[model samples]
Target: MLQAKVAVVTGAGSGIGAAIARLFAVEGAKVVLGDLAEGGAAFAAELADDGFEVMFQRVDVTDEADVAALMQATVARFGRIDILVANAGIPERKSPIHQLDLDDWRRVIDVDLTGVALCNKFAVGAMLATGGGAIVNMASILAHVGQENSNAYSAAKAGVVNLTRSVALTYARQGVRANCVSPGYVDTPLLAQLPAAVRQAMLLRQPIGRLARPDEIAQVVAFLASERASIITGACINADGGYTAI
Candidate 1:
């Protein structure tokens, strides 16, 4: 559905971000994979080997200049950006609000919330110059339901939801569409670090009887980034396997 479009996906080194990059490329987008991890270059090369148009660029989403350079480089390579997936983020440092280290909170907020803002800031600028485009910010189920000891992540994701709405409203008439996807427990590398029992507990909590696959969430993102969702803006689509339903 994204044939010939230019798309940029942050955090595209692995997990859901990587999945989105792969899918977008397969769907015919000239994809730019931006990540701090070296894996992004290898992954982009892998996609290129498969005959998809792809490129990799290292980015520190928390650094405005780095992010701006990423967007600028994308336009320099692909001419214009048609879609952006703001998916770069760090996991929360588990701690109660009262005991949460201020630095830890800032770290999560910087990468999760502020990173999305930076990506949006430059992506919107690039889109506006090209007559508009679509954006899909990555959020999480924690944005809607509380998670123990994950206060900062929830807050950041919640900020993303509203940030998406704000951008959508502010740029609707300008032709830019913004939306987000909130995913539940997914079988990504991030989840592999948890204890087995914890993983099982999370799996059991999913009404779908299993954790979602990263590609499943990527599918939702891809849909939102395409004209298939042309009328969807400022919306948060849940790909949570009913985690928030109960």
Candidate 2:
């Protein structure tokens, strides 16, 4: 359904971002993958070997220049950007209102909140040139609920929730659509890095008794970006495994 469309996915080195990129390519989108880590390049190479149209760039989501180049490079290579999956984000462990380190708080906010802002800033301009496009921002289940020692992460994602709504309203008449996907803990490398106890707690949050698979989250992203979701905008889809419902 995304045939001929160009999609840019941030943090595509691995995990949920990578899953989104791979799925988009399978749906016929020319994919632009970006990550601060080297994994993005390697993943793109793997896709190239498989005959998928893809490009990779090492990008710092917090950097305006990096994001601008991503947009520029995408248009340079694929002519236009029709889809943007702003999936790059970081979660901080110390988020207690009193004990949270100021620096860590800033870093989380910069990457999680500011990063999405930059992607939208540039992507919106590019999309405007083409009349409009679809944007899917990666939020977290934490955005809606609170957790001990998760203040920074929670605050930033809460910002994403409102930010997405604002952007949706801003571009509604311009043919642009903005939506958010909030996924609970997923079985990704990132989750594996968490303390065993923390990981277990994460699994228990969902009534399903297991973490989500990255590909499952990607499926929802694909639908929202496709024509099927043409009427959906400014909505937040909880991709969590019934975590939010409880």
Candidate 3:
């Protein structure tokens, strides 16, 4: 799998990012975990105690200096970076487009869209210098379909999807591969924070009658990051449990 690789996963404190980091570690990558939450450090410590090569760094992805330092720290510790999972993002509460607060809209866009840009800026430069690497940006089902009252999230994710393609095309010849994963209704801690009714409604909308598990998304990411997907780049793989099929 990822043996000998140095991998960076944003938002690795929990949810899909944490799952990806754990999977990469199990597959033999030295994992560098970053997130704004303190839990990210604890997660890294726990994994390191279990004998995994893991490091934690506090980062607000939206901040330029923080993201640059995150990449530099990983390189300093691991020597070279082989993979990047741009999975840090935030979702806004539901609000009609007309009623959506300007601040909330900017918040989502900053974290979801601009954050990925900053990560890629540093990650790609490192990858190019190291000869080549792989990237998996976490998008969402909203990237393709409409999600009422989630304009900012949807728009940001859509931007991620396109940004992935652009990166893939621009750097594939240079040995850098970029792809995206669009997940639907994953039962992460973030979902637990939603209102009971909102959660239920999401569950009901899933054709499988249950939310996607974080590991499921991680499996897809692992595949995209592996040599098995060597010919795959600029692709968007959907893990929506048929949510967009209808």
Candidate 4:
């Protein structure tokens, strides 16, 4: 489905990012996986063992230099970039407004919001070189709703939504398509860390009565990154299992 594409996925060491990287490789795209974790290289090796076009890079998305290096390494290895998934992010600690640490708030903003901006800036230049590309950003269902003591995370994701729109408009005529995917609670390691009560509450909130699988979210991302979604740009797809339908 994505044959001939050269793709970059951040936070690809695990979870949703890892799933997207593996899926894209299966569809014939040469993929570059970037992560801050040590396991990224191991995952890349595993993918390559399966005869897939893939590689790994250590990247700090919040750093302009690291993000630039990721894109440069991708182009050097695959010729040009055709798809970018700005999926690297961290969740803020749950805390009341008055109890929130300033450092924590700033850190989340930098990683979740500024990091995406850096990825888009560098990716845009590379995509422009090859005519155009697709960019799928990871937002959250929390972007549309509010939860007590989770203001930082919600705000950062909300920023991503608007940032995606701005990117799409700036490059709409230049062949860049940017969009956001807002997912509800997903069955990821992060979710596992939540207490049983919290986890069950999240599950009950989903109309489907279950959390989303990482691969399910990956499939939606894959579709957005393909020509099959040619006319789609600046739109946010709610992959929330009808949670926002109400």
Candidate 5:
């Protein structure tokens, strides 16, 4: 569905980002996988061995220079960018707002919120040059609701939702479409790192009594990036398995 497209997926080494990259590749997009983790190169290599058009780059989303380089590399390799998934983010430790560590808060904001800003800045520039593109920013259910002891992550994701809207409104005239996908408790490596009790608590909070699969979220992102969604923009679709429905 995305033939001839070049897609850049940040945080593509694992979890939702990795799933998105794989889906894009399966759909015929030349994929550029970016992440701070060392696993990014390995992931790309694995996909390449499978005969997919994929490349990997080590990128620190919190660094403007690194993000700029990532975009530059994508264009250098593929000539033009058609899809950008600003999916890199970090979850801060659970703590009350009043007791939150200042550095932790800043770190979360930098990676989760400012990181999106930087990616959008560079991706939109390329899209405008190419006359159009699609961008899907990864947000969370926390974007629309409060989470106890997750002040930084919740706030940063909330900013991402609004930023997605702002980008959509500003660039639709340029044929650029921007939207957000808000997922709740997706079972990814990150969630695996959490304590069992915490993970169980999150699962129980979902009316469906289960965490979403990573590919399920990927399907939503794929739809948003396809011509099938040509008329959809500035939308924040929920993939929460009914967590937000309650």
Candidate 6:
């Protein structure tokens, strides 16, 4: 669906971001994988080996300069950025609001919320210059429903949802569309870190009775970034497996 398009995926080192990068490449996009982890380079190389057009750039999403550089480098490499998946974020350190450290909250807010803002800011500028493009921001089910001890993460994700809407509204006539993909608990490295009991609890909470796969979420993102979703903007599509229904 993304044939010949130039796409940039942040946090492409592993997990959902990696999956998005790979899928975009397979769909014929010139993929630029950006992450703070140097490992993203190797992942890009792996994709290139499969004869996909891909590149990697180390990017600290929370840094405005770094994010600007990412968009610039992508334009330099692929000519123009047709799609941007702002997927770079850090897992929150769970703690009750009363007991949460200031640093923990700030860190999560900075990366999860501010990083997305930075990406959108620069990507939108680039897209405007080229007439138009699409943006898919990675949010979570937490954005729709709150969880105990996850104040920072939930707040940040909720912020992302609104941020996407604002961008969509602001650029609706400019040909740039912005949307959010809110996923449920996914079977990624992040989920693997939880205890068995915690994992089971999440499964029980989800109506699907199984965690989502990274590729499944990637499919959602790819669709949002493609012309298939041309009329979609300012919408937060839930891929939560009915987690919020109950």
The candidate that achieves the highest lDDT relative to the unseen native structure: 3
TM-score of each candidate structure, all chains considered together: 0.98, 0.98, 0.99, 0.98, 0.98, 0.98
Task: Name model 2 segments beyond 4 Å from true.
Answer: none
Identify the runs in model 6 with alpha carbons over 4 angstroms from their true place. Answer: none
lDDT of 4 by residue, 1-246 (tens): 999899999999888899999999999999999999979999999999999989999999999999999999999999999999999888788899989899999999999999999999999999999899999999998889888789789999999999999999999999999998998988887677778988888887889988999999999999999999999999999998999897
* Residue runs of model 1 more than 4 Å from their true location after superposition: none
Clashes of each: 0, 0, 0, 0, 0, 0
Task: State the weakest 10-residue window (summed lDDT) of model 6.
Answer: 88-97
Candidate 2 lDDT over 1-246, as tens digits, reads: 899999999999989999999999999999999999998999999999999999998899999999999999999999998999999987686545877698898999999999999999999999999989999999999999988888888999999999999999999999999999999889888787778988887776779888899999999999999989999999999999899898
TM-score of 5: 0.98
lDDT score of residue 60 within candidate 3:
99
The pairs that clash in candidate 5 are: none
Q: For residues 1-246, write the lDDT of model 1, one tens digit per residue.
A: 999999999999999999999999889899999999999999999999998989999999999999999999999998999999999988876777889899989999999999999999999999999999999999999999987878889999999999999999999999999999999998888888777988898988999999899999999999999999999999999999998999
Give lDDT tens digits, candidate 5, residues 74-153: 99999998999999988788887789899999999999999999999999999999899999999999999887788989
What is candidate 6's lDDT per residue for 1-246, written digit by digit as tens? 999999999999989999999999989999999999998999999999999999999999999999999999999987898999999878877777889889989999999999999999999999999999999999999999889889889999999999999999999999999999999999998788888988899988989999999999999999999999999999999998889888
The models' CA-based lDDT, in order, is: 0.94, 0.93, 0.95, 0.93, 0.94, 0.94
